[model samples]
Target: MSLFSLENKTAVVTGGASGIGEAISKAFAGQGAHVHILEFNAENGERVVGEIKAKGGKAKFHACDVSNNVQVTEIISAIGTQSYINILVNNAGIAHVGNLEGTAEEDMDRIYNVNIKGVYNCMHAVISKMKEKGGVILNMASIASSVGISDRFAYSMSKGAVLTMTYSVAKDYLDNGIRCNSISPARIHTPFVDGFIKKNYPGKEEEMFEKLSKSQPIGRMGKPEEVANLAVYLCSDEASFITGTDFPIDGGYIKLNG
Candidate 1:
């Protein structure tokens, strides 16, 4: 048997429209899983599903806002009717750049709603169904989850919650055969990064991009596919013995940097 083959499995990937989430969606589909992408961007979501189908993979797109509990539950419940969800990748999140003093109360609230509550809503919506059959849950965390970073107070706060939630769910569902884990990645080279640099740095975009990439000890930003590869392994039955762990795909940013 192929080590990471996902044949006959069904996967639900939140925020599977772009970047790391998109990479994961494609990787899972390539491995023979039926992927259901829950995303807020209708265009990108539909595009991803269409591309997957064109490649002879099964994929469906659900227009969803993960921060909305009612919407998340309703969508997930609808998906449950189709198949037993075997893998869930919670990759939906927003980023904020600010220290405590710089962060507005509204900013904190917005981050909390999507980053923390979104994870809770998705997990809560699926846990009961997952309990009936063994499954894997992977939450996309950040290096900020464990270590302090400059000007990311709100983002850090939400990710810290994510790491703990991962631990809690893994412990709570151990007997039920649900494996929960998190992936903490540092700066990843994505279109979002490029857009951010272009919008903020303008003529200095390349300089800022290089600076951001060099922040990691590995000397360059990690690739989305690199993170997706680890995700695939974790979600596979080959990793059945693993649970309640946070795998850092941070390009040595968490430890070696210091």
Candidate 2:
């Protein structure tokens, strides 16, 4: 059998319309799994599903807001009724760039609702269905989840929750054959990063981009496809012996950056 092949599996990927989530959705489908993309952006969702289909991969898009429990539950339930969900990639999260004093109540609440609670909502909605036939869960954590990143109070807090939730779920569902793991990425090069630089740094976009890229200690930002490749391996049956682990896809940031 080919390594990391997900043939006949049914996978759900939240925020699958863009960035790392988009890469994971395409990769999963390319490996023979039917992908269900849960995304808030209908335009991007349809575009991604179209791209996947164009590549001869099976994919469907569902208009979803991961932060809304009712919506998440209904969507997952409907998908579960149609097919057994063998893999779930919780990649729906938002970022905040602020320290404690810079963070406002609304800012914290917004981060909490999407980053932390969204993970909970999707996992909660799918756990029972996965319990019936065993499945893999991959949460998109961050370097902030483990290390202290300056000016990221709220973002770090939310991701810290994601990291711990991965552990708790992995431990709790072991007997049920559910394997849960998290990927802690450093700076990943995405459209969001470009926009963040353009919005925050203005004319110094190139300067700020280089600064952010070099912060990873490898002199570059990670590619979404690289992270998606790791996601594929972890979700595949070859990784059956692994569980409750946090895989840092940081470019030497976690260990080498001092």
Candidate 3:
């Protein structure tokens, strides 16, 4: 059997409704893993699940506001009892464009709640279960984690914590066979990009999109499936010896550009 095979495994992806999260969910299902999507958006979540099912993949939906501990704990616990949570992908996050001086207190709190605390909550809820079963954890960090991006003060802060948390968790659980890692991606073409364009650029949406796409040295944004392919590799047995590291799937933005 290929080390990439996920035949007997199960993966839980928060924010599995769209973007990179959607791609990861579908890819895991394609690898023969049972995928359960936890997302705040029921409509998009159901749509993704439907697509997976149509392809004869195994998947389900769980409505979630990952920032809410009570909700995350209760739902994850219920799911844990039925089957071991083998692989957990913490992909639930939001982006904020503001520096320290321009960012609002409310906005900072919101970013911390959903971006930082949200990952913490879900990890806390499932870590013990994962330890018992010796599973994998993949966090969706960003280039903001290591390098400063313009007007991303709060976003950068949260992602830095994510990268560290990946290391911290992986270190603490090394003896238990639990592995944790993070993926830092540069700009990717997703609904969020479209929405940002529509809301901010309006008539100049295409122009702004092209600008964002070219921000990467590779001259284009990444596709969700590309990110997903890397994720599937990291979570599979092939990466069993790989952990405590952050994989930058960015288009040479971190190194080549520098």
- Residue-level lDDT of model 1, residues 91-205, one tens digit each, is 9999998899999999999999999999999999999999998899999999999998999999999999999999999999999999999999999998899988998899998
RMSD in Å for model 3:
0.9
Q: Compared to the true structure, candidate 3 yields what TM-score?
A: 0.98
Per-residue lDDT of model 2, residues 128-225, tens digit only:
87998899999999989889899999999999999999999999999999999999999999989999999999999999998999888899999999
Ten-residue region with minimum lDDT total, candidate 2: 209-218
State the lDDT of candidate 3 residue by residue for 210-236, as single tens digits.
898888999999999999999999999
Q: What is the C-alpha lDDT of each candidate?
A: 0.96, 0.96, 0.93
Per candidate, the number of residue pairs that clash is 0, 0, 0
TM-score of each: 0.99, 0.99, 0.98
Q: How accurate locally is residue 228 in candidate 2, as Cα lDDT from 0 to 100? A: 94
Q: Residue 45: error of model 1 in Å?
A: 0.4
